[model samples]
Target chain A: MKDTKRQTWMGLLARADAGRVPELLGQAGPSPDFEWLRAPEIGSVMVQGRTGGTGAPFNLGEMTVTRCTLRLSSGEVGHACLKGRRKGDAEAAAVVDALMQTPAETLMRSKVLGPLAEDAARARHCRAAKAAATKVDFFTMVRGED
Target chain B: MYVAVKGGERAIENAHAWLAEERRGDTDVAELDIQQIREQLSLAVNRVMAEGSLHDPDLAALAIKQARGDLIEAIFLIRAYRTTLPRFGTTKPVETAEMACDRRISATFKDVPGGQVLGPTFDYTHRLLDFKLAAEGEPVTAEQRDADPAPVPHVTEFLNRESLIEEAPRDDTPPPDLTREPLELPAARALRLQALSRADEGFTLSMAYSTQRGYARNHAFVGELRVGTVPVEMEIPELGFAVEIGEITLTECETVNQFKGSRTEPPQFTRGYGLVFGHSERKAISMALVDRALRWEELGEDNSGAPAQDAEFVLYHADNIQASGFLEHIKLPHYVDFQSELELVRKMRREANAQTREAAE
Candidate 1:
């Protein structure tokens, strides 16, 4: 059976190997500052095991991971990498993942990107609040007189 | 270069030293020897043996000490050791009829052939705790009964002569080991019974109890409950005969349950069997009941959809090791999955609020 996810992830791995992943993925430079950017969407990544020999029970290890980046019209960057057993599938999945982050797509925007950003914000706020509350003042207690 | 933290190794060493000191406890008090735990704390050792599928009391006691008296942890230690031990050969089926009985009871008969020997049971004991045992007591002389060399045949074998109970077919085929293999759906009687035998006693008891409470009620009578030491024999390939290797104490419970007559088949009472390591009558009895309950489908009984009736559910969740491992693993890091869910709910609520404002406007 043709596993689409495995195919997609393998494709990204191939791209990475070719040293043209950034160009094909359309990334100008390595930018970790892009908070709104969605991770690459890979289809089901095929996890292959060590081929002991021919005609042996094929062991699938883990899904190959792939991802992509995209810049939305509102300058909101998004990316997705498709993971699969094959190559071409990964590139397509990543573009689709990035496109889904656009405001124009309601289902994609609501289901995927909006929630991710909101979660990130909530986590940051919660951490900041906790840090503020735990701010300890080094003060010595007054000794009580008999 | 900027340094973050240090002294992890030193801190670990200090913590271990403190733990050792804590284990030792008060200097004045005598330390609990391994032998004392092996003999005096034998019930704990038995539990570890049954669960671990190992029989070494000394090793089990040592494991219990190392685990700080956690019986399950000791069982795990024993199981780890058991897995590493080489399997030289498989043992022949133990002959329980040849068992040197410690305790044998039959609920089916008013008096069985070999007679009911109530050896070391707390059945008729009053709730009052003996004050003598509270303090270090003296060793009392025990009276011995005249030994009977006569063998005790199974009650079901006699019933088989009259064609009253269903004849259990004896097969020489090797049974599946639950510990060695992953459990599959629609398990055979051998596999199901094997799983229940080593299953958690409390869990098995509750499941069996549920059956008695009208859920897949088999109307089971304890045909016989035998606890004794039986000789373990392994076949010598070159000699072409089985040789007695060692002896192991076993608790075997056979339940005679109510039978329904089918159109094609004769009306005969069904049997449920349970066998476990050590003097674990509770586990053995519970295992028998659950085993009988699981056989409803084969016996042409209606599906009750009870927890006991669900083979997949019972077999999968029965092991304390698997149950506790999966149950306690939730305590480990789950921030990644939680973060995903968190984001989804926040956006969903936000969207709902936005829609409500729009409607009000």
Candidate 2:
């Protein structure tokens, strides 16, 4: 619902520019050929691949990626680069960039970052709840007085 | 009263000194010199160069020393250093056909033009431990013959003549440098081969092994494996043409893969290629097999849904440094997330207890 186009544009630019989100904003234009930076989240890949450790093969490596740049009307730029895919991700990233830099930062935060952070928090809480449920408290009433 | 942590900087400085002391070990013990590490631990140097994507033996030696012999850490050090150094310029592609080979072999053909030369290899040597190496010893040098002047052409060139192998058209387009750019999925053959060459040897080997063991199986035969020094040329903007910048040791592999002919296509052997830094034949051969498997889609073969055939999957997760860094980062502070979870669980538990009590009553 927020203007994701602006925020995602910034992210796409940053992704294109080697994860460096730019400070100066200008007219966004078509990306050059050499923009994507391929940095994969390997820990997750390893964990996912390890689901059937005996069956799955895991590689410890990196890739060569390209990214694109776009500017929004709010004079903000966005960039994003992703792994294991092509520049088709650039369009979605451009929209997210457009929204991230708008007055809708709060809305975007609630709609996007907040949910992800909360889900992460919930996962941690579930682990803690499981651990805490195992806790034992011993109590004994005095026998003599009555 | 508890004191404020005013000496944080000093504490850091002292901790670094103590760490350095620990790294150096006892003062009485003979120090491991950089040259000693470079010469004695040459395989470590090759790995650092391969993974670091740099060719400086001295720098690799220094990184190995700094990293306390942890090869992966040494590679990380080398890579970080490589990133900081100013790029004077990139070299023109090395001419593989003009290589002065120290070692060359062909599994596809026993007798090929230029004759198969196994110049230096440990392939046939027995693995029995030799106790004579325990003490300082000098190896007897084999008599040297004056090497031939003519450049040995590549074995693939012969296959290209008859069109037995797929046409690997030479392109002048500049290939992407993986270090300078992030990796993307669905990479071209050039990009995939580039990543695999510098990928971790063990990782590359296992991935290649997996393909052979039926995962995205692409039957591959080593067309050729050659190790030698090749001239590296770079074009000077001032000169307007390319000139030899230097020469570097490289291991190049070409695999002849079974090409399943399509209705529109003819039956011909396809190629899987790998070229890597140093005398690393095993790494290069493995890389070639994986490279061919990754080419299934481009070649119009049926998508086997195998791991090796998935270029997106293979290229995205091949670097050990990236893998290790992310894997180790879980050790960093996450107490903030932990605290939030703590509150949520406490609230949930209290509400659950109340509901249970009410239900019992």
Candidate 3:
């Protein structure tokens, strides 16, 4: 897959619902042999922040994130880092990532990435519409001037 | 001649067992569920999340339940749990300007953009007690209205446009984390705010109140007090673009205080800022006041020897966990020291009596 395509899918996987990842991988079926370079492990990552959007960096806080690494039979390496403690999601994401680097790239994109992207877009749209329903516009009347 | 009291281990064990039984009192009544605490006593959960320096409501609720409604103890439990968690990459500083405000009000200006939205607040409620609420109460349905989509311009910005308020210079330096590093003396404003954010609410509130009572009075007007949710984003190194990681609810406050002018500088309104996790307006406002009081040095004003203006004193005593631990440690064994003191006093008294008798003879 192209770098842009890989980036898109990786972004989708990062934000993807953990439960949905397993269902998508199940539909994609089993892939060629692969070895886990790093099995899915639940841990945390230090969250840092700037003073403002443009200011100097500061340690904001920490958040729980899961990560995994694997290598496919075709010699392509894949890694996944996702928010929260969903081990299965990280594993499935890593497998799909590795598969994306091989001949099965097209198949993986269609089966896993495509559906997840659509779902994500739909969720965003729903939230936007809900927020819009409450949008208000305030206007002031111009007072008489001498 | 005092012998060491033994069997403390068994006594401690028995005491703990009895305490556990007391905690579960009246099994006949339905036990308070964590969910009930999370939903019904949400303010307590918010306090725990704020002072605990963690945002997980469920864990806060669980901590509250475990601590038996002692908010400070719950905060301690959450803080302890927080230390064990791993550090993820930092998010970009949350943009409060873009917050979807549920409550936004300005005391300085009666009419401002994003017209005063008095979201959910207890400010207007009468202090009278409602006997009905003592039992199971009916859910309240609030009247909903469309919120203004236009970004609410801060009240201070209006003053800034005319050079009335002091310009807050933009600095890009990273702030120090009190949780990760030991707090040093003469803290920066950023570090001071971080300490105040999680400091004991009562201590901060009282300190702030002292400033209002003329200890180091800086006449303040609430420029803006807002409660809302702000999206948190993080720059992904590989992607080279920040992505929305999550959103968190926050209470933010900004106060405009009396300006100080000297030969070198023109008089301009100074600002005090406070931001904290969850809807903790009291904590946020108190934090802002204390923050301003502590800014005496930077603002080039003389410190009037106020407790709130004393940075070291405020920071030292603000941590409830530390204060409680030191305060309660007196209950531990002190018999050895007491016995030594007793012997010394007796010897001094005997010597004094002998000296007095010699003088009489």
Per-residue error (Å), model 3, residue B244? 2.6
TM-score of chain B of 2: 0.90
DockQ (C-alpha based) per candidate is: 0.01, 0.01, 0.21
TM-score of 1: 0.66
- Candidate 1 stretches with Cα past 4 Å from truth are A1-146, B1-23
lDDT string for model 3 (B106-186, tens) is 888877766677767788789789888988888874554433344566677788889988766556667788877899997
User: What do the candidate models score in CA lDDT, each in turn?
Assistant: 0.62, 0.61, 0.76
TM-scores for all predictions: 0.66, 0.67, 0.80
Give candidate 2 regions above 4 Å deviation.
A1-146, B1-15, B348-361
Relative to the unseen true structure, what is the Cα RMSD of model 2? Answer: 25.9
Name the better of 1 and 3 by DockQ.
3
State the weakest 10-residue window (summed lDDT) of model 2 chain B.
Answer: B238-247
How does model 1 do on interface RMSD, in angstroms? 27.3
Which of the CAPRI classes, incorrect, acceptable, medium or high, describes model 1?
Answer: incorrect
Per-residue lDDT value at B200 in model 1: 82
Best by TM-score: 3
Ranking 2 against 3 by TM-score, winner = 3
